[model samples]
Target: MKTKIIYLLMACILLVSCQNLNRPSGKMTRVERVVSGQTIEIADRSAAVPVLEPIRLIGIQAPDIRQKPWGEEARIELEKLTLGQEVLLEFDVQEKDRFNRLLAYVWFGGKLINEYMVKEGFALAEPDFPNTKYMERLINAQERARLMGLGIWNPDQPMRQTPAQFRRQIGNRE
Candidate 1:
């Protein structure tokens, strides 16, 4: 009887932990600024002095600031959606990227901002593993945006290359 009870308890614990692997519930913070389409500065109110931290939106990549009008457009759109708004930051397997930016799925105004950006073609769905909680949704949104020829996906004026590729090309030129 003791052995059976221990096994049952262990199984239940495993199940619960597995369900929370992505850490869906997260810190509620206010956006201090929109740094770019896929990044923002958020106020960490839990700190006594309200420290500002950079948060990189997970599962998507926006045009680099050097990408001409496309980049500026993305930044402006992000600002309109998130600047000064209170947001929920859902974490994933890895908390921060190498750049020390907090990686999160930002929720605001009842929308997943990351996915929305892709859906509207302001960004592209780029899945970074260990943080793919919403990649599928983002990819689907991207497809729809592409089909509709929206924003960056517009056939007549589409962004010439992915942001990562553009960055690499710029680095090579220097």
Candidate 2:
């Protein structure tokens, strides 16, 4: 069992390293819409027909839409930053999620939007494996946001529940 696990781990590492070698140069695309705080739709013109591809911002998770004002605030903030704007998409190890949403670190005006959202306290640093190239940067941004008590970190009206928690609760109810 131990040997099997070791081989599996090695294989995973090898696969990830191979994927990293061919990292996509920033693909410039126009934001079609904001699905939520952490997701956006972009017009992908790579194919014969343009397709609206949903992108899930890597390294951070924002409040769920069911999380009341915090969720809406996050959506609004994301919209303010990205809606109708041309943004650059940088991919890491995994290019897409199980939902087929493109997983990327978004950049606008030379700023990493994923880190910006965490720094602004609009989202929490949620590291997902094999796609954590910017995890430390995001965690540091979250710390700064926490110290400054911005957005969801505000002492008086802070977001009490995490986006994951909110999602689980909603899922249970359904």
Candidate 3:
């Protein structure tokens, strides 16, 4: 009886560990809703009843809703790409931003969604600390977009400044 009980306890422990280990790691959950250009509600099973949490794509900057020019276009494009689809979220060092949003590198199917946004000129590389895994890729994508005159990259585009420059300009304006 003692041996049977010990075996049963071991089995239960192994089962619990296995279940925990089976959880998705570094994988983007499905997009439940698109909140804006900078935020999206992702379906996360880790919470009770698969709650939706806003995920902020790290290392890049998409236009803010209140910002000038292609802000709406950026949000539209993001919606078109990932409004109701499953995406893979890759994390670097920091997992969450100051807003308590999940900071991730989003991927849909086999495509890198974050890089695509930059390549399409809807976003720009905006690396923050250790989340620089895709910094080079984002930069290259932005360059390609500029070369191709995509999205906000047109020669006549008024807001063709880099994110850093844009922020500085805004500060100066104030």
Candidate 4:
């Protein structure tokens, strides 16, 4: 009786561990829309009912709305690449942001979207908090973009100058 009980307990533990391992470490889903240069909405198939979830790509930083002249173009490029396609999201360590948005490394048909954005000069490697999975890739991409003079790399682009520079140039005219 004692041997049987021990065997049953061990078997149960092994079964549970195996099941957990079998669960998808990463999931592939269709993107509903591109939210910005670094984020997108994906249709989640894991729930009992299907749902569209916003996934913030980890380890990359695209130009923000308040950034220099090429910010909008960066966003546009991202939209063009992933607006309506199926992508595979691979989770590394952290899963969600403070807003409960899923944080992931997005892959579209074997292409890594985050890395592509950086490589194309649309974004920079943003190593802020739980999103450091692809830091090396992002850095390399940024370097390449800078070398090729793409997007924000153009020196003649107009943008909102810093407050100090504005003050100096305007000389209290406002």
Candidate 5:
């Protein structure tokens, strides 16, 4: 009986290992909702909102809604690109943020959303995060956006504090 149990355990391990190997590093999931320019809710089922997980786009930070400069524009741009689309998510060293949102590299049509956002100038590179997998790529994209004067990168616009700085400043005021 002991031998039989050991065999069963081994079989289970092998099965799990094989399953993991078969699954792509970039897991396929559908976007149920766009929370903001930096975060999205993903699910397999067809739901209006999201019953699954909230995936935060890694390596970039979008402006807060209170920023008033480009916050709404960023959110709208993200929604235009991602709502109701199938996205593939690839996680880095860290899994989740302090907010419990899954930190990931979101992909759509073979393009990385994090990089795209930076490239489009809707977001800024978040260097403090441990997930620096695409930091260089994101920085490069941001530079291109800056050069091209896209989105928030336009020099004619008034300078606005980043989401991180806004959060910190708000905290200090309270």
Candidate 6:
């Protein structure tokens, strides 16, 4: 069983690394971990070696696990969509964040995972950043999700806090 999983992983790694690192579009990376709704750990291994890179999805912010149900839901949704998949990573003006995680728009199965996250109401559109590559799409999705009251936007539930707001509160408290 373990061997099969390992082989599958290796195959995915191989599939993603077939392109040049300097390609204009982006790196083809295999999703290794869904760290959160907005973050993931991807790998690009060439020559049968392993190289893991943490990635932060651009244009959206999902609830943190500290936010309870919303966070957990978002994480699960991301895992369902991207775990073990070979996703294409497209960059904008900013390549990486302060934490050194690659900032990108992730595509899986020809669909934009970042936009899907917002469309499902699992995340909020983040327009503060300059990328704006998929800004309109993200914003529209979030609006639709909000109108539908799906996931975190459900009216019956307690008011949910944005991950950024939570981070700020945590910083101030500490």
Report the C-alpha displacement of residue 22, candidate 6, in angstroms: 20
Give per-residue CA lDDT, model 1, range 102-163, as digits (tens).
99999986689999999999999998998887888999999999999999989889999899
Tens-place lDDT per residue, model 4, 1-174, is 999999999999999999987443478677887777777887777799978788888887676644555566777887887788766788877878888988898877667888888787677767756557677878888789778876655555633443235446667665
lDDT pick, better of 1 and 5: 1
lDDT per residue for candidate 3 within 1-174, as digits (tens), equals: 999999999999999999997443587467888876667787678777888888898777877654577778888888999988978887878989998998887888777788988898888777678888778888899889989988777777745665556677788989
Clashing pairs in 1: none
RMSD of each: 6.1, 10.3, 10.1, 9.8, 10.0, 12.6
lDDT of 6 by residue, 1-174 (tens): 999999999998877886554334677878999989899997756648877878999989889877888888899999999999988999998888889998999988779999999998899999847788889989999899989998888999944567878889888999
Report the C-alpha lDDT of model 2 over 1-174, residue by residue, as the tens digit: 999999999999999999998454678889999988899999878899998989999989999987888888899999999999999899899988999899999999878999999999999999889998889999999999999999999999989889888899889999
Worst 10 residues of 3 by lDDT: 158-167
TM-score of every candidate: 0.83, 0.83, 0.74, 0.68, 0.77, 0.79
lDDT of 5 by residue, 63-91 (tens): 88667768888888889888999888999
Look at candidate 2 and tell me the lDDT of residue 76.
92
Which runs of model 2 end up more than 4 angstroms from their true locations? Answer: 1-24
Rank order by TM-score, top first?
1, 2, 6, 5, 3, 4
Candidate 2 lands at a TM-score of 0.83
What does candidate 5 score on TM? Answer: 0.77
Cα displacement (Å) at residue 120, model 5:
0.9
Q: What's the C-alpha lDDT at position 11 in model 1?
A: 100
Candidate 4 has its poorest 10 consecutive residues by lDDT at 158-167
lDDT of each: 0.91, 0.92, 0.80, 0.74, 0.84, 0.86
